[model samples]
Target: MEVTTLTRVYRYDGIDLPVPPHLAGDPSALRAYHATLYPAILNAEAVDLGVSNGALVTEYRRAVGTKGR
Candidate 1:
């Protein structure tokens, strides 16, 4: 018998992360959603870079604060 290993990816399907109807075309809601998603993005980047969560969080907060202002 032969064994083969399968590669894995942590990709998220959109179905599990649906956007709210009210937020679809609203700029403010879009901004808020972007701000909220920044942290997750940072975390993913941190994992890729093998960095600390603090740095990613700092960057996320900075970006969110500036853009969400």
Candidate 2:
């Protein structure tokens, strides 16, 4: 038998950030948590990237129309 631990990652503002253990498994909470770190994320959208390399991945995308404003 083999056991493996999965990690969580957040991809926002073109940067890959390691997700805090407490925020794992809760997408909305994770996003709000990230917003504290990156205020701009408050206006962004969360996009799940599923799992990759044994880690859960998510991306935050800002509104396209608000780019230049």
Candidate 3:
């Protein structure tokens, strides 16, 4: 049987945070877990960076305000 493994990485604050295996497949759960680690991530947007090097890269970008202009 052919087996494939998925590696998930969370890019935030100019650092790469490896996602926990248990929360890898669950986006909501993953986000919640990350929020616990980085409260700012609660408002961050998850931007999928697509797969590279057999790993899934996701970036959590904080929302920027436009000064209500």
What TM-score does each of the candidates earn?
0.26, 0.68, 0.75
lDDT tens per residue, model 2, 1-69 = 998877777899889966787778788887788888888798888888888999877789886773464
Looking at model 2, report the run of 10 residues with the lowest lDDT sum. 60-69
Error of 1 at 9 (Å): 22
Q: What's the lDDT for candidate 2?
A: 0.82
Off by over 4 Å in 1: 1-18, 39-69
The candidate that wins on TM-score is: 3
Using lDDT as the measure, name the better of candidate 1 and candidate 3.
3
Output the TM-score of candidate 3.
0.75
Report the C-alpha lDDT of model 3 over 1-69, residue by residue, as the tens digit.
Answer: 998886888889888876787887898998888888898899899999999899888899999987564
Model 1 residue 44 CA deviation (Å) reads 17
User: Rank order by TM-score, top first?
Assistant: 3, 2, 1
C-alpha positional error of residue 19 in candidate 1 after TM-score superposition, expressed in Å: 2.9
Clashing pairs in 1: none
